[model samples]
Target: MPGVEREPEGAGSARRSLAALLLSMGVSAAFAVAFIVVVGLDPGITFALLAALLVSAASAYRVLFGSPRRAGGITVGRTVMAGALATLVVFGAIQAIPHGRDHTNPPVVSEPAWDSPRTRELAAAACFLCHSNETRWPGYTNVAPVSWALTDHILTARDTFNFSAWEEFPTSARLIEAAIRDGRMPPWNFRLLHPEARLSAAEKEELIAGIRATLGG
Candidate 1:
């Protein structure tokens, strides 16, 4: 019993190190989900980024501790982490920039050219998504980083010509007609999801004429 040997101190250090790494990985994972849920970020992207973070942190730790089993893996992991972090930062900044507008259930300030039923229908179908207070916000709108882009587009569109505040802004009939004629107002991206917004040539002409008559172009 007197000659029994004790395990080396290095073994204890290695065990502690592994425990610390595992704890860190668990914390990072929990935070990642919290970030996605709290901010309403795209879950797929967030999970992918979280995986990258775990891989990178693990690899970096291995490399620093002189584990040469997969040196190249460590390099790749660091690169992925850097790129992902940069992307997240840029998207985060965009989201943080307030456009000084709130998406509220505000009272309708004015009405558009309701001279004809079809005219009203066209406006409701195509222009309401971004230009009116009755925006039917899509599920995707809640998910960033796409949400950031969508919000910015909506704010800009409203600022240029808000149909809800038709009287206050008083947009010209000619401009409205031109926007539809040139396929500009309801941009292509918008039409991708809302096929109803994609007006045919006849429909466009009818809408334009209605706008001209109603708004006195």
Candidate 2:
């Protein structure tokens, strides 16, 4: 016991490298989780991406910094496994939320009966996602965090306008035209994701004319 031999005072290269990996992963994961939580994101979607990111980062680190020995491999594997488990839990929790999985198009009660086929076509192409019963929910909407935000916007938009429920508004044509002219209807943020909603000057004018004629303002 008195003549015990010591290997070294400092950790080995492999141990040091493993420590670095864990430190990096921890920092990155903390930032990501904070961002997701702060934004009120659906953890399911955000965590899945976070898991993938962790795996990718580990792989990149191994490649760049040289592969770890058995201990390091075990460490990485355990971290990845933990990440996967976290993702699954988040996803399950998200599935239990209301309207979380209601990305399907609801039944149309009665769309505004358009007098002009051209106006109908234009509306279908540009405003359908938000202003109609027929919403083409994108693949991304199937995911949680994004789905939540996008679904909220669509619901709010429908509540505001809803060409399908045009009869209720009475002065729908004037309101719609004014909103479009001022570039406030489709909204700039919506247009960024949905380029089709971005109308040209001429297209806007034509759409206004068509709406006026159809609704008889």
Error of 1 at 70 (Å): 4.7
Clashing pairs in model 1, backbone N/Cα/C closer than 3 A: none
Residue 161 in candidate 2, Cα distance off native in Å = 2.5
Q: Ten-residue segment with the worst summed lDDT in candidate 2? A: 70-79
lDDT of 2 by residue, 1-217 (tens): 5665765433464566586577657866785665464434556766665766566655654554455464444354545554455556655666566764687766676666677788888777778888877888767777765677677777777787677666553346898898888998676666777778888898888888988887778
Which portions of model 2 show Cα errors greater than 4 Å?
1-98, 168-171
lDDT of 1 by residue, 1-217 (tens): 5765997546655555465556666766775766565443457766765666566655555554455233322233343454355556545555564542345545678876578988878888989888877787657575555565566667677778788888775688888988887887777667877899988888888888888888896
Q: If scored against the real structure, what TM-score would every candidate get? A: 0.58, 0.57
Return the clash pairs for model 2, or none. Answer: none
RMSD to true structure for each model, in Å: 12.3, 8.4
Q: lDDT, candidate 2, residue 69?
A: 63
Indicate which candidate wins on lDDT: 2
Per-candidate local distance difference test:
0.67, 0.68
